[model samples]
Target: MMDARHDHPKLVLPPPTYPAVLFVMAWVLDQHLIPPFIDSVSSAPLLGAILVILGLGAAGWAVLRFMRAGTHVEPHKPTLAMVMDGPFRFSRNPIYASFFALFAGVGMIMKLEWTIVFLPILWLCLRLWVIAPEEAFLSSRFGSEYEHYRQKVRRWL
Candidate 1:
C-alpha cells in the first residue's frame, strides 16, 4: 500500500477562532442590541424592499462578472495576475464587495440590523487575513506590474 504522507510541509490552518467570536458577538447583539434600534425604523415600505432587491441583484451581477473575468485563475490559491479591468476597476476586490453588498442589502430589506454588523467585520477579516497576504504574494510574484495596477485601483469602492 502507498503511504499518503508527503515530505512537504502541510498548509497551516488560518485560525477561524476570530470568525467564531464575531459570530457569537453578532448573535448577542441581534438578541439585545439590534431589536430596540430596529423598533424605531423597521417599517420598510414596498418600494424600499424593491430597491433592496435591485441592489442585491446588481451586487450578484458584479459577482458573476468577477467570476467570469478569468481573473481568479486558481481556486483557494492567490491570484497570479492583478485583475484591474472590468468590475475590478471599480473595486479591487469585487467578490468581497459583492458579498458585502448582498449581506447589507438583505439586512436592510429584512430589517435585520444586526446582519449589517457582519459587513464591516467581513471586510476587516478579508483585509487582514485574505487581501494582505494575497497582496504580498502577488507583489512578490509579479513585481512592478502588480504595483502599477495596485496604484491605479482602489482596494474597495
Candidate 2:
C-alpha cells in the first residue's frame, strides 16, 4: 500500500521523531536565550534521569504489546487488533505519554528553561497532527471496540 504519511507530510510527524529534532532546537534556543548555568545542578537531575528511562521503558512496552497483538505500531497503517494489555491498561497513548515525559525530563536535567517553553508547541503538534489522526483511524477501523477501550483508559496518566 502507498504510505499514509506521504499524503500529509507537513502535519504528520511521528512522535518518536519529535524529541530528536526538537532537542537540537532546544540546544540552539539555550545558546541564545540564557547564560550557561554557572550554578550546581539540582537533585531532580537524578529524578529526570529516572523519568527518561521510565519513558523509554513505557514506549518500548507499548510497542511490544502492539507487536504481540500482531498490530501495526505505526498509526498510519491499519491495525490488526485493539491492544488493551500491557501499558495500555492505563493510558490510551502510552507512547505519546512517554514522549511527554522524556521531553520534560530532558528539559529539567539540562536546565533549559526554553525547552519547557516550547514543550507545549511540541505537545500541540503531537496531539493535533499526530495522535488525532491515529485516534480517528482507530475509531474508524475498530469501531465500537476501540471506543469502549478509549472510554475506559485516560489518554495519559
Candidate 3:
C-alpha cells in the first residue's frame, strides 16, 4: 500500500493558517473598502441571524466529522480519509461555505454596508487561494478517489 505520508504532494501555496489572519484583516478592512456611495446593508434583520446560525452549525458539523474521522484539520497536513458525511454531504467545501455565511452574517449583524462587495471578494480569495489549491492537492494525493468525491458533491451549496 502507498502510504499517504511517504509521498506527500508538493503544495504550491503557503499553508492556509496565515490566510485566516488575512481573512480577518480583510473582513475588518472590507467595511472601509466600500465606496461611500455604495455602502448599504440588507434591510432584513432576521436573515442575517439565520445565516449566522446556519454557518456556525455547518462549521461545527464539519469539525465534528473531521474529529470523528481522526483526520488532521490543518490545511498544511494531508487528510488520511475522505469524509462524506454530515454537512459534507451537502457541500464539499462546507467549511469555506460556512466561513462565507459567517462573514456575511457578521456583516448583516453589524450592518456593515460594504459587505455586498466584501462577501464576493472573500469568496474569490477563498476559492482561489484556498479551495483551488486544496482541490489540486487532493487530486494529486488521492487521485481518482478525490475526483469521485468531487463528482459526488458540489464544491459549494
Candidate 4:
C-alpha cells in the first residue's frame, strides 16, 4: 500500500539544520568539554586542526561537484537529472554525507567527546528528517529507476 506521507514532497531545507546544529555543538564542546578531557588524552592540536581543514575541503569538493553537474531548470528548484557520476556514484547524497563526515572528523580532531556524543543525533536527524523525505520524493519522481539505484548503492557509504 502507498504511504500517505509519500503524497507530499520531502522537506529538504530543515534536514540541513542537523549539520548547523552539530557545528554549534562542536564549537561549544571544544570550548568546554575538550579542555577538561585533555588532562587524560594527549592533545594533538596541530593534527586535529589539519583534519578539520581536510574535512572541510572534502565537503567543499562534493558541493562543487553538485553545482557543476547541471543548471537547474527552475532557478530555485532541484535539478531534474539524477547525478550518478562523480561523488554521487559512491553515495546518493554526497553533500550531506560529506558534511556529516566533516563534522565527525572535526569532532575527532578537536577531541570533543560531547560533540562526538551528538554524532548519532546528527545521523538520526538526517535519517528521519532529510533522507526519508528525499527518498520519498526521488522514489515518487523516478520510481523504478530510483529503486534500482537505491538497490545498487548504499545511501551514505
Candidate 5:
C-alpha cells in the first residue's frame, strides 16, 4: 500500500492545531502577561456567544458537506472529492474562517485582549501554513476544477 503520509497535503502541523495553540497561548498570555485593553462592553458576552454559535454552525455545515461528498474531513487525509456546496459555496476556507470567529468570540467572552490582538497572526498562520499547502494539494489533485473554484470563490469571507 502507498504511504498514507504521501497521500495527504504537506502541512507544518494539523489544521486545527493552529487555532488550538492560539487559544491556549492567548489565554496563558492574558492570565500571566497581557492585560485586557478593550473597555468592558455590556453586550460583549452576548455578541461573543452569537459569534460562537454561528462559527459552530458554519463548521458543522462544512463538515456535513465533506461527509456527504465522501471526502475525509481531516486535512491530514487525502481528499476524495472537492466539496462546493453549503458553506464552501461562500468561502473556500469556511472552516478556517469559523476558527477565526471562534477565536474572536472566545476572546470576547473571556476578556482575553491577547486573543483579539493576535488574531492577525492566527490568520497569517492559517493562510500560509495551513490553507496554502491545502490549496496546493487540491490544485495538484483536482487540477482545473480546483483552479476554477479558486477563481470563483474568495478564500475567506
Candidate 6:
C-alpha cells in the first residue's frame, strides 16, 4: 500500500491564501484605482451580511467535520478519511465555496467593484491551482469512493 501522506496533493499554496491575496488586491484597486460600482445600493449591505454569515457557518461546519473525521484540513497534508457529512454533503468544496462567498460579501458590503470584478479570475485560479490538484490527489488516494462522492456532489453549489 502507498503512504497517503507521501502522496498528498501538490498545491501551489494554502487554499485560503489565494482568496486572501485576491481580496486584498481587489480592495486596493477599489480604493485607489476604481470607484464603487454603484453610488449606493441600500440592499448591498444586507445581502452582503447574509452571504457572510452563511459562508462563515458553512466553513466552520466543514472544518468541524474534518476534525471529527481526523483528516488533515490543509490541502498539502495527507487526507486520512473521506468526509461526506455536514456541508460536504452538499458541495465537495464547501470550504472553498465559503471563501468565495466571504470574499464577495465583504466586497459588496464595502462597495468595492474591483473585488466583484476579480471574482471570476479568483475562481479560475482556485480551480486550476487548488481544486484540480486536490481532486487528482483524492481520486488517486481514495479511488472509487472519491469518484462516487464527486459524482454526487457538485464542485460548487
The TM-scores of all predictions, comma-separated, are: 0.63, 0.84, 0.76, 0.73, 0.93, 0.94
Candidate 5 per-residue C-alpha lDDT over 10-42 given as tens digits, one digit per residue, 9 for 90 to 100: 898988898889889998998888677655686
Q: Give the best candidate by TM-score.
A: 6
- The deviation in Å at residue 13 for candidate 4 is 4.4
Which digits, one per residue and each the tens of the lDDT, describe model 1 over residues 56-134?
A: 5655665565467644433244343355666767766665565555555555555656655676786677677767766
User: Roughly what TM-score does model 3 have, to 2 decimal places?
Assistant: 0.76
Give the per-residue lDDT digits (tens) of candidate 6, residues 51-157: 89999999999999999999889877777889999999889999999988898888888887776788898899899999999999889889999999999999998
RMSD of 1: 6.3
Regions of candidate 2 where Cα sits further than 4 Å from its true position = 1-11, 36-41
lDDT of each: 0.58, 0.77, 0.71, 0.67, 0.87, 0.87
103 Cα displacement, candidate 2 (Å): 1.3
**Lowest-lDDT window of 10 residues in candidate 1?**
1-10
In candidate 4, the residue pairs with backbone N, CA or C atoms under 3 Å apart (3 or more residues apart, or in different chains) clash, namely none
lDDT of 1 at 152: 85
Query: Considering TM-score, where higher is better, how would the candidates rank from best to worst?
Result: 6, 5, 2, 3, 4, 1
- Candidate 5: where is the Cα deviation over 4 Å? 1-5
For each candidate in turn, give its C-alpha RMSD to the true structure in angstroms.
6.3, 3.4, 3.6, 5.0, 1.8, 1.4
